[model samples]
Target: MQEQSDNKQPLFYEIIGPAVLKERIPLYEVIGTLREYMNIIDRSYLTLTGKDRLSKKEREKYKIIAYEFNPGSLHIDLAIELYEIVQLVFPFMMPAGATGLWDLTKSSYNFVKTVAKLRAGGEDPVIQEDNSIQSYIIGDNNKIMVNPSISINSDKIEESVQKIGSFISPGAVEQVALKDMEEDGISITEEEKRLFNPETTISEDTETIVVKIYRLDIESKKGKLYILEGMEPKDIPFQIIGDQAIGPYIDALKADQLKVNILREMAASLTGKPYLKRVLLVGFPGIKPNQGKLF
Candidate 1:
């Protein structure tokens, strides 16, 4: 498990300003509009070192959105999460056309790569290297993209929502409270520390929210298999078409039209409101439904 030392805070920029159009737009058109107004979300963190030795070794990034609104200040928890919600919709609205649609529902890697390049003196590693890892990132391969993330802090849930409504749609969103903290020991590097801090208003910037996007291709308990590679177990029971494999998990893919609409409505609301600063949407693995025996 090698660790990635080059992690940095993700940036979400808006290509389109907050303005809703009366006409209904196609998915591609939405993506194109978002490209014009790009929004950056999510920050990077250390995973493991790629030494192939130690107890753990693999350089990767972890997703953790941290926002600091006066660490010791009094505020509503939901307001902060709402603030996070505002962060989520902002990015989705901008990258509505090609970039957004292409990377749509896939993952936030492309969005993260774009930030890395912007922070790296505008020198895209992918542009210099033919096999740059960033090439796999959805939007980076061709153009700018948007990725979104969602999370509600339990203790700060109330505050997050209220404050966030000021930025996003002023509606009541369902907030589910969890009993325990889902702690995953994701690592972070010096560079990532600098990047993550400002985006969440934790250490540096106070006006930005960070997000990460991921691919929702498989079930939570099921490991992913590249069907085209013919490496899956014969009992797995699946079919491969082009680069994607149609397996039990494939059924979960949300309809493109539906996804677009959901995003569009979100965009319209956030854009319509002028009280928000920016929304950071992070992409990641989609939640898989349980296929066990029904009760």
Candidate 2:
């Protein structure tokens, strides 16, 4: 079990929380929560020095979502595990359970190679990245994404809404109380320190970021599956009908119209918002090369 020494994975995480708070998750939030979960699983003084080993339970508790440099695409596979994700974003009781949905839900967060890029220099524009709903959060100031993935209810989930509901009011009061201590200079115990660590706000320049996706038109060219002189050709998955038909697998993939429209609407909505100060079309993984000739 080697120590987690920081691999490079840039990510922008949005967690829709209870009482309707949709926010881009910072790296510190991930670190702070992971620190709490790690300490709970195993931690002595040696743990602080980066010599700690993760146990089986600890490994299952966190999911590492790193950005992959797929040659021509900047896209996530988009299969999300709700529970494990919550522990990283909000390592509290009943992650993704009824109360957990309110605790944290990951929705449409951008993945990058590094967080420092989000903190880039120069007159960078910011994107608020918010969709507001009335009376949902902060007296009509709720600026979060639409119904989050974690918010969907299911019998398959393993948490009691009752338990989470019980904690919300008390938790809010406690947070407000602790916030007051910032001015008074109160000391937090070691136990409270991990779970209650406050993240300092970053510069306003980095507050908002915009990502623009472009649609591309590709020309289908004649592709040949050439084999070596001494080698045998592997069995093809589909029958080749002249140079026109590629394979059944290729034919099986049809453009998802609903999803395409939804994505376009999302990009358009984020184009101008009060919160985000910058916008960049960093990667567009959804853009794929068309194998079929234009009709």
Candidate 3:
């Protein structure tokens, strides 16, 4: 691998299997796998920066540059760069460039490693009293701190895991590892792919809760809800069920608070937190349905 600066370390991805034995992998597999890998890094960066979305200019600020491709089972080295954004401390003060690229880089690597461990049925990493998840997977016993609550895009992270799993489904690639410059990283084998499948359970009883609709697709009859009051308020994906016309509940989308009875379906995770799945909306309190507009 090429030598990088002190603050920079080339991230390597090692794909191992019979297909790569000859130092060649299918073009489609390489493209698809690399695409998802970039997505993982992008999402992790967003989480660490505490941003919901990156602007067009900001997207260009963060990038993963591929530098070298080696033999020995198709090893690829990548470097991440985050450009400095200059901001003036005061109107009368000179502009100062702010950069956390080094910290963000290390945290991003630790984030991917933690995700891999979670997918392999590992326990949730220990969260410190300050709410940062500390991991010791980097070179020479380096500790990386990741704050779980900053702005975790769990759905995006899970999607990346599923996509990576699909790429391995064809059996060409038996396993993949995300490693640092020294090749210290986590591996996800074919056998452990099944662990990424979410464990879902449906509740037979109907329950009432207050929630706020974050997004709703009228045609797909699918949406997301943010629980306002309950055990722990969180965003959960929900699909309308039982042929109830969604037209009546269009107002729910604009409402600040909604009281609804629903049948909850939850997906269990190794982290002990059950993800909310399909929610059957049984009743909407205080909203009058327009009979004439029923679809």
Candidate 4:
């Protein structure tokens, strides 16, 4: 690892296989894998900091810089330095001194270790009182605790890991290892790639609910909905399942407060919590039959 001017140590991600024997790597593969790696870090940071989104200043302070590339199977060195302001702005309540910069570093390291465990097809994660996760490392079985919100977005992390795995090839790129400066980390082999697939069971049961559409992408058939009935409202990401026309969703967006009955499809996790996945529009309330049929 290269010497860092700051107190923070540089992290390394090495792509191992015959492809890197020439001390060179493909542009697309490296770039794509790096992007997913960054996403994992960003998601972990958001969960640890308990913030919905990072501000412009916070983004600058928590930014990761890829400074040096080392020989021997293509290693990328990355570094991140957190400021005191970033720690002080924790919106959710955390234990005193838990929001320190070193605490953030430890959290980040634990996040990667947790991902590694999931990739290796470990047991179901232990859900904390705050709905966070507790994961154990593979070899040493070290416990890592993560304090996250109800909307932790574990699906995103799964998606990112799958994306990174997609770049792996049998003879060319066999394994990718994410390690610290001391060379302690997890290695993801090609055969273990399938472990990152999301374990979700589609429910046979369906429910009709009213939700306010916040964002919609007609081409992608995906949108975000805000459920209004609960004591603590939640914004859920959903995909249009069937060949449903986009007209009704567009109308709902324009109407803003229109109540609509949607057949919601949910995915149940190992924790037995049902999460919204897809929706099919069934009926529109307070609208004339002819008007509704027009959509």
Candidate 5:
């Protein structure tokens, strides 16, 4: 439970299957993996301090490290962010053990709120207030994660897609697909025109509607594996190092389905208990794996 900070390092974990009987998925193994990833990052990024006014080699190293860790590795500062993202994706993945998942989510959510509050008055807000307005509509973190999973269904997915009809702007021809809609001067379907035509004059009597999002945490060995629609998905593993290893270790535990099963098998092997069970995907979102869809 070491605190994550900019000056320190962080770690992430994944569990594939049953929670109980896990070990080859041990804490230290994850910590070791993280250490390797971080030491290299640190060796390059550490400050030039006191006498050392910064060396050319050090600066070059820092650039290389930054490039490697940029969007993939969960660095110290981003540990909490990643945790919040995980919670947003799966609200109840962790158990109500000594330290409850809800409480953890609340803590993380509050931390973001506090930062938002501080940022609101600053010269520049690091994160746009409206960027996460969905969090406000959903209230707490757990609600944000759960509501969307249940609300999104196969039937509704198509319905909503059809109803929304591409989030286009005024005077735009409705395109056949979302991508086509983005292009200029594309023709739209009648249904799409009616739903999204900004030019259509509406009477003041029109009523507002609230669209609810369904919570989903699609679980499977390939659950984490997703296609980013037109783009490619990056396979970035969590790297944990130093005192902040726990977070990444936990993340790694949550990532792989087979890892969880291995942990359970190991636990059973050691304890010989017939009922040492642990729930997997405690709050998994049931988004069907539509390989073509954007996660």
Candidate 6:
């Protein structure tokens, strides 16, 4: 929806979740409570015309709303961004639907391909680029909503993380046979191809390797979340807000466990712990996680 010059007041942009049984675990709700404290930010004001002219003093009061780790909250990100354009970033909605920020990384349109959105139920509608910021809900008069459930299909994000890791340390690590890794939307990096060739010097001893990344969304040019060994273990619930959220959480949990163990061995090498058995300092290069002398 494009921003329109109209005679209307700003409304809370509402987001709806999928129609699933068992309340579907509101990503914003946990064991039995809603995390409302982090959900609401202080109010900020902007209009369709004045979006680009926010003074430093005004932006200082911009409210940042944080939702639980829910994929249904995809609209929240846009809501926050759109808030900069219009005074209100959210919209009103009927009860009984899911709301909050959800991950859009695995959504069908996010397959690194040009995706078009068509009319769900209408006589005839012009196809719109699904991921276009031009269609953003800011200043639109019509109802706007997105299904985080819709974006949960693809597994490309996990593969990209794995591939990036592989690029950094080729055959030095093991891989899980994740579904749809070879699918059309997903890509195989050059490092992945080299892994298939036995003669390739995929592994080489190096002094250091980068741990995590600071990646940006290509289209939006927006900063996104980064998963590294250190953070995932401590953030199982929050990590649920990503590509294939549940599955990736489990995978990352496993990885973080190995990271913890490796860090343990490393800790021991520095100075032996009192009760724990000492890890013999073996000057091994290219030691992969779960496959080194820590065992």
lDDT of 2 by residue, 121-226 (tens): 2112222222232111212232222222221211011112112212223222121101011122111223222212212222212111121111111112111111
lDDT of 1 by residue, 21-53 (tens): 224222342343222212111111100111111
lDDT of 6 at 244: 20
RMSD of 6: 20.3
Best by TM-score: 3
Candidate 5 has its poorest 10 consecutive residues by lDDT at 260-269
How do these models rank on TM-score, best leading?
A: 3, 4, 1, 6, 2, 5
**Model 4 TM-score, 2 decimals:** 0.54
lDDT by residue (tens digit), candidate 4, 196-278? 43344554433446578866656455666766753135555566555456787788886556565555554443344554444
Model 2 misses residue 171 by how many Å? 43
Model 1 segments more than 4 A misplaced: 1-114, 117-188, 196-254, 259-295
The regions of model 6 sitting more than 4 angstroms off are: 1-22, 26-78, 81-202, 207-295
Candidate 6 Cα deviation (angstroms), residue 247: 38
What overall lDDT goes with each candidate model?
A: 0.22, 0.22, 0.57, 0.55, 0.24, 0.24
Q: Write the per-residue lDDT of candidate 5 for residues 1-295, one digit (tens) a residue.
A: 2343322222222212222122333334234433432332222122111111235643432221121221121212212111111111322342222122222323332333333233232311122122223222333332222222221211112222223333222433222221111121112244443422222121222111111111212121112121122212221111111122133223544442222111110012112322212111211123222223211
Which residue segments of model 5 deviate by more than 4 Å? 1-130, 133-142, 145-295
Candidate 5: lDDT of 104? 30
Provide the global lDDT of candidate 5 against the true structure.
Answer: 0.24
Clashing pairs in 4: none
- Greater-lDDT candidate between 3 and 6: 3
lDDT of 6 by residue, 38-126 (tens): 12111012212224244666554343333322243222221222233233332223111011111122132232121111111111111
Give me the displacement of residue 27 in model 4, in angstroms: 1.2
Error of 3 at 79 (Å): 0.9
lDDT of 6 at 155: 19
